[model samples]
Target: MSKPVILCVDDERIVLDSLRTQLAAAFGDAYIYEGAEDAEEALDLINDLNEEGISVILIISDWLMPGIRGDELLIQIHKNYPNVIKILLTGQADEVAIDRAQKQANLHRCLSKPWSEAHLLETIKSGLSKL
Candidate 1:
């Protein structure tokens, strides 16, 4: 069977690279990582993945991006891909944003910035299991 796919969105390239490496190491070939600098690109990739019959089972996104806030991006994702688990990784999310995202996207969890590698891997595993 094909491996599960995870879509990770962050404006910082370093964060994206780190996540790709770490997730690959932890999961081996069990995940397909789709990284994007902004929500628009992520949306495009999600569409392509859906067309290819590969649904994104999880999304890990940052909140303070340039084009779209992480919560907004996840909300959009929920609109089309409601079953995909959504997570917000940010250091600056306010209570209002969190509340809105929780209602709109059913946000699974929020991880603070500079998250521990172990915690991240564990959270991802749990999120995927719940899906």
Candidate 2:
């Protein structure tokens, strides 16, 4: 079977770098981590990967970004890629935003900022297991 592809979106380069490093150590070559500064760029990467016959199985996106909120992006992705698991990594989780994420993105879970590494890994493992 092909390795599961995981696309992670975060505006902070530091966060992205750290996530890539950690995910690489945990998942090895079985996962692909694509960290983008914005949702638009992530969408572009998704299209490119799709063309290459790479199907992304999971997405971990921040709720707040410079362009295109995470909920909005996930909504678009859900419209097209309904099978992909959507997760939220964000500091802001208001009731309204949570509602929107649930209704539009079908968010699997929302992990807060300053997440513990063990927790992150465990959550990701659970997300992948569902596939």
Candidate 3:
């Protein structure tokens, strides 16, 4: 069976690269680290992974994107895959949006854009522990 996936969605290439590096460094090869530049692509990839029987354990997404916003994407994912842990990383997400994600998406945490690597790793570890 495939390892669980930890997906990151961000519009910025640099942000995705950073996530890839950090996640790999922290988690090693225990899980698959996937990235998508937009919500549509991420949704497609999630569906594909699901069909392939690869569990997606977590998603880290940016809030402001060109297409669907982060909260909306997480909410959609929650609708189909409630077990997946969701985290929103945003520089400018408002309280309303964060609240919506919390209620609708079971959002695990909301971290500010300039997130510390240590905090991010801790959040992921905490989320994994719950699973």
Task: Write down the lDDT of every candidate, Cα atoms only.
Answer: 0.91, 0.86, 0.97
Which residues of candidate 1, in runs, are more than 4 Å off?
Answer: none
> What tens digits encode model 2's per-residue C-alpha lDDT throughout 32-71?
7888889999899888888888899998898898979988
Pairs that clash in candidate 2? none
Clashes of 3: 0
lDDT of 3 at 78: 99
Instruction: Using TM-score, give the best candidate's number.
Output: 3
- Model 2 lDDT, full chain set: 0.86
By lDDT, the candidates rank as 3, 1, 2
State model 1's lDDT: 0.91
Candidate 3, residues 49-110, lDDT tens digits: the string is 99999999999999999989999999999999999999999998999999999999999999
Q: What is the per-residue lDDT of model 1 for residues 12-81, given as tens digits with 9 covering 90 to 100?
A: 9999999899998998887888899999999999998888888799999999999889999999999998
By TM-score, the better pick of 1 and 3 is: 3
RMSD of each: 1.0, 1.4, 0.5
